[model samples]
Target: MDRSSQCDEPSSPAESPSPPAAHGENEKNAQFLTGLRLYGVLIGTSVASFLISLDTSVISTAIPSITTQFHSTPDITWYASAYPLTLCSLQPLSGKLTTIFSPRWTYQTFFIIFLLGSLLCGVAPNSSTFILGRAVAGAGGRLSLYSFGTILGPIMGGALTEKVGWRWCFYINLPAGAVTVATLFLFFHPPQKKPATPLTPREKLLQLDLLGCVLFTASIVMVLLALQWGGNQHPWNSPLIIALFTGFSITIIAFTIWEQRQGDSAMIPLSVLLRRSVLFSVLFASLLLSSFVIPVYYLPEWFQIVLGATPLQSGIYMLPSVISQLLGAIFSGVLAKRIPYYNPWFFLGSSLLCIASGLYTTFTVFSTPPAKWISFQILQGLGCGLAAQMPLLTVQATLITSPAQIPLGISLVLFAQYFGSSLAQSIGGAIFQNILASQLEQEAGLDKTQIQELLRAGNAKVRETVAESFPQSLNAVLEAYNMSIFRVFWFPVTGSAVAFILAGGIEWVDLRDMASSEGSENRVVDEFSKPGAKQGGSRAGV
Candidate 1:
């Protein structure tokens, strides 16, 4: 069992304080050591982060090419879904895994896996094969990479689309990953292993919660599958959807009961869940993530349908938002150190995102001002960056006193965001796509066959339209696109409102209390660090 996954220490409702270690810390002076050296870890993490974030958007430009190559929407869609599916499901497990394996090795292991997966993805010969590769690479995909890539997506998109071909985006990881692996090996020596006393056999056997783990797994997997296939494969009322949803609900309930019953030995410690900062951050992060994700998922479709840009060109246009996200993460991390009152950054960010989403809600037809679109996105991007570290910061402030749950706690917050996104994108996509299809049918007097043919035109599809009169058909599609996008903004606005509410709720656990609690927690985090830890596990936040 991954140590990070099954923590031995009491995670919440702080157990009776054992004798403070001779040198043990207290709430007053928790682990400031990690915070002091935040830059070193932050910088290294940023490099890895940029690579991952770059991957998400880099593919946005290539979806057309992917659809053209794969010749199926489901296949192309799998490339995106597969990565998140695995990434989301395994998040909490990583916390446990890190405990057993140690952070340096844990990070290195995933980095290698992601890199190898990227190589296979870039060279895949068939759609199924490519999807398999994407799944592998995205399996336990790194979080920092996702944030960094999102931050610098604009730069990467420009470089990948303009200077090189779209496929190279995946291929680009080869050198970067190599350098990262080599650098870590060369420079990052592991901290001396503190001699941990062996666990009693009874303790080990008693600690296992296989039933809870299995139930949690079932809950997330069922939900994600339902979301993926709900609208596209089966109608909302279909038996398959109902069965899947039913399974999801039952499993989730079981997992929750199992966790609460299990307590300290639970898959996710209850104390962690009850922690005000961790709890609020996870909720807010989940809501905010919906806003961030819909744009990435839908904007490409909008660009292709409305802007008449190529798959690659659309990728470039979406770059600025990602660039802004990177700046936000770095700026916020630095700013928090200077300005002790952290909620303002989150407030400013959520407010800006709300404003942007509100503005987008009133978008015009294809003739809407480009500046307006760009500006709102930039504002949205800024909000994303600002909020990036705040939730994590909140966890450090209010919930995780130990380094043991630090990464796990971090993963939980991210998992929530992804969970929210998965739900939103799957449902939201259905709504937008369904709306687009119906509106297009009304506008284009064209039948399904004609629409399929039009969609097949892709980057150069319109230029090759069989009928020169296709623009009339396109009008309905564009009109639908405009309205659907308008609807999409509501998700962000509502999410922002929720995030703002949660931000107000997190208790400001002082940083002084962090080091001691962190040290104690780090001591016990040895039980749970599976790569598949919290991916889609029982916990909504994890």
Candidate 2:
């Protein structure tokens, strides 16, 4: 779908378009693309996003199977962690890549890379090979819409594993990705805008900040390595872990210095980071949006370990939260488009998210009432749904009239989200494992030797094997699982609290007016209504 509106010529004050009328009819029309081409592109985008996001959780359900097949126990976390590690590392670079090359070409290139990774994963003969494939896929699809992909992954993985095999999980991506690629190739081409300057080939390559990206990737990977191994593979105070942490800090500092010096050409441009909306949006995505990752990752474990539900059943149980989130986002989008004021919605969403996190913390092994967990999930999903896309939306609204800045704005928000999610997951895993280990020893009455063996056995096996072999200790083990998951809830609670505070700083942008030529001037309008305001008119300070 070549949905190219001629880049609106830079408008003079007197050349601005007519104000959008009541009902935001003009604004709605401006955003819509008619014809089958549009539909094809939209469908292709959704399918691509689904596969990308699904990768985040698909391997999770198949983790045990993969471990058993490969006879690898130590690197189980890497199956999941490897993808996001590369993803978070390269997402910002992908955004920059789009700017320097054709968005269509860049997207297709990544899609191809992702396909190869999936193929490798599907046919892998060992854990190392499989992890490598996941990392490759993660790097390629890092900029794809993974938030949505993850929502449906567990169920898809379970069903696929049950029907075909665990290998089919990665194999499934091949056909789906091929179909999406073909559709996109037939229909998708974003409107092209001439670059501000025609750069030499060398200049364009330099603009990508390859060195900075490598340094930053190294830094993040080091930190992730430390997190993954700490208190599990190695003692928290081990010199190797300490060195990794130190290397991360040093490398990150170097990357920051390089980026600051590189300025506009840097992978993450400093100028964009300096903008108020961009800065806040990054924070909101990192702290608030990423909080969603907690339950998405652990809730399945909760169901499997604590409640003894199968992976498919656990995925089904998660629908309340997932569906509510989808609905909340839709409702909020409608409200944002129709109403001029959106900060209140942001405020409401964050406040609700905080409340929901608090509610989930109350979950216990005995709290098996479906109603309670379902209600809690609904609340969390609704809260997340309302606010999930707001940060990026705000960034776009602010840059509506500045087409050139839109890509950077989006990339910044996504980087924050991916980075935050990866960080949270790593830390969350460390916390969960450490607590589970301690609880098994202290509360489950396991001797040190038994605890060590259990820790090595992994959560899924420990729960199943312990329940069968040690009936008296099963209750204690389940309780420990409950507590560990509960403690992880505090991270999101704290994150949402911070998000609520930061959300207050989001300047109000009316979607109705954002379609007009004067959007840039009015982007950061006040939230309150003006006196004697006309129905469906612009708000105060707009």
Candidate 3:
């Protein structure tokens, strides 16, 4: 059982491996930061993480406000999907950019880009600018920082939307980002690395794989257009939508061929993708992460629309789920440390997700009990939390013996997460919009124009508008929204079921044992964690 056999082709060395001296951080430069200085850097990184994480889900609660302001109900899917679309597309390139430039410089550049994106979003006069700004903000440099934002973004967004305005959601990021820039400039510094030789401009551009990125991005955009337009704006049988789907398949094939040719220089290296554990991790992570995001986006809508809660109230309503998720993640880490296997945790989590998604399907216009919703949310959160982080960990453990694959493996898992989330939001919007339209037309007797008007008015405002004009039809319209939202549960249910199936196929090893030897521990730190040694000390474990 050689490690190379795990890949489709034997694992090859990197195209241009870093030199011995470039292993990261010279001994003399590794002096410890102490007193106030270390704390400043730590707080700075955490604040940066917080801001990035907040951006990931902040739009969840602001959608209704944004839709109202832009009056672009047709483009609602783009509002949610745009960020993830760009985020997923650029994630692989971020690491390469970080390596080519120093981390500090790269960090500063991305932060500035993110700040500009936020400013644009805050002052956006039209839907196109807002969506473009979101895409730019989403593609801001690091996936790891975004992961933290996903955890707390909804609550922050909801509160901001309620207190100030939806614009403040974007505006808040400006000051926070300014602080991050200041801190990084003042406190953060990685040892400088001089390339063995200066590279030509063409060589530098080739290292970034710009062509492959464009092809892959184009393919994804085609798939999104197909999904967004089919059976919604256009018929499923329409030639335009069909052509988009066809183009997606062709471009994906071309991208695959290109990746194979690039070998080690490929953005998502072909050899790493061929590994069985890596494959399973990508699938499982996509499914599980989608499960997490679907609820985050929709539950607030449910709270505001069905229960007549304000934005702040909707955020408050989500406390059970958010709190439970954090608890479950903490417990899962503790359990993983002690247990030799991960399948039990996976099974437990997915089973809970299945039950929670099923329970959500039971929600109705009259289902206003706080306890029922809270309990269901808690269950769903616990389920996703328990298994959400496992895919990455399991992939790392599988490649413990093949350290070079760790970075690619981690990146693939993360890419699946963002990509799946993008798909989930797009599909959810399509389903909800289509069903809501039909339900309003057939059940509530609203015409096409009226339905569009109502949707453009915003979810909370829709109820108010209808109640004032057609009081008798209010209940019917609310019921239509309820049923339409309930239908969205199927997405997470199916995602959880698939995750449960994939979890069983994951390869597991005793991670603690894998890192027991000092040399192996160093290897784990070198491979799975950050590239450079810390200013103060070295960290152990994968």
Candidate 4:
């Protein structure tokens, strides 16, 4: 009944003999880096993480400019969604690749891919090309050291866009990526654990579960396309939209059946996913990220369009949110070591996020105070930061008995996080577009052509154009934009509330005790095997 059995696969004759227990322990200890070399690896990986995190957030402030240049305002959803879509879909494969190959080489391969994608985006001539580049970059990216880069991404993106051009936002990755690649090549000496069975290159490739990845990606794309096109490019009841949704349901069901049959080799191991701790954790991570991404994207638009702030100014305004999120993350991480139960932090964090999102929906075009908006942002960021990382920690804690399962468990949660962000952006964009169009038509009395012109002009040009030509309807137009954005805020408001409820479902495990017990792993296996053990119930004094 050992949990490790679920991760087992058939052995190969080419595999090397297993080392003695004592020798294996020594090998494990030898892998631990110390001194300056450890610091160098940290620096290298942290920079890589920064690049990945920066890519996600930097495009937020620059979206307005990109839409303006391309005159493809409707494509805003794809601009942000495309990267995360590929990142989410390809994440499990990346994890498997690192397992089959050396982490150092795998890391470099992904870095090169990311750099190429960045170059493509930097020189992209049109909206479609840019979105393609974003997807390419996303395929090559992985997650790590998130907060610092995320804090600087918006500000840096805005400065680069205004002072030079938005392309610089992507161009900046080349130099940074080169430094990361060199540092990793030189200092990253991860101890290689000999696989129980050595496989040929073809075998390793087959283990990637490419079909599962494709099916999963197709299903997600179907849903996103439906959301993006619904009520915007096509009617909600249109054939194309209906087909997309139908495809999503069918593909998702197929993906589930395939994964169940694939067993341990599945892209997402159903055995690990079925655990109560992991299931709730995955849900919480998805909802928390969805809530967080909505504000990160739309707040910049609100600042630029409604408040009349420049891109640089809008980025500056985001400082409160980003900085607060970092602080909240740090605080929760530190407290987690001292506090026994993680669920409390989850509860408090989700509560704060829900409240902050509700406050966001009350924002007005003219009367809302700077202090009000800033405080709400701080609250939202703090909540997101506090809860954002708990799911990973929860998975690691729950699967402590199965050391091999930890990586896969973490990957599943990470996939959910990015997938949620991707879906949120598409849904938010749809809401914003549909509501804005309707309000402009009814309240501002603008026709379809006029509305399209205003959208193509970009957020920065909206007020100016309205005042210049439609002076009589300028106030109404601004009001329409404000109302549309506020309506979009409701999505996160609902998301955060749902996350709060899911937080209660997280199993209560005392980390301090888990670390103290020498036989904790055996104890965990025993508890899991129990017939009537209530999932997520307290395990105190076990």
Top candidate, metric TM-score: 3
Candidates sorted by lDDT, descending order?
Answer: 4, 3, 2, 1
lDDT (Cα atoms) of all candidates against the true structure: 0.60, 0.69, 0.73, 0.78
Worst 10 residues of 3 by lDDT: 533-542
Model 1: residue 352 alpha-carbon error in angstroms: 1.8
**Which regions of candidate 1 fall more than 4 Å away from where they truly are?**
1-50, 74-78, 102-108, 125-129, 143-148, 158-165, 181-217, 327-340, 400-408, 455-472, 508-542
Give the TM-score (vs. native) of candidate 4.
0.88
Of candidate 4, the 10-residue stretch with the lowest lDDT total is: 533-542
lDDT of 4 by residue, 1-542 (tens): 12422211111101111222354464454545678776777677767777877888898888888888888878888998998889888867765665567656766788788889999999999989999999989888752324357778899989988899999999999998888888778877655556667888899888999889999999998998898889989999999999999999999999999999999899989999999999999988888888888888899999988998888888999988887887787787777767887798788888898899899999988999999989998998889777776776688688888755665776788778878889999999899989999999998899988898898787667888788778888889989999999999999889989988988888898777787778765555544332211112100000
What does candidate 1's lDDT look like per residue over 298-323, in tens digits? 66656765677765567667766766
lDDT (10s digit) by residue, model 2, range 331-426 = 876666666665776677778888888888888898569998999888888888787666766766666566456556766776677677778777
* Native-to-model Cα distance after best TM-score fit, residue 196 in candidate 4, in Å: 6.7
If ranked by TM-score, best first, what sequence of candidates would result? 3, 4, 2, 1
lDDT of 3 by residue, 482-514 (tens): 888889989989998998998777776655666
Off by over 4 Å in 3: 1-25, 35-37, 141-152, 508-522, 526-542
Candidate number that wins on TM-score, 1 or 2: 2
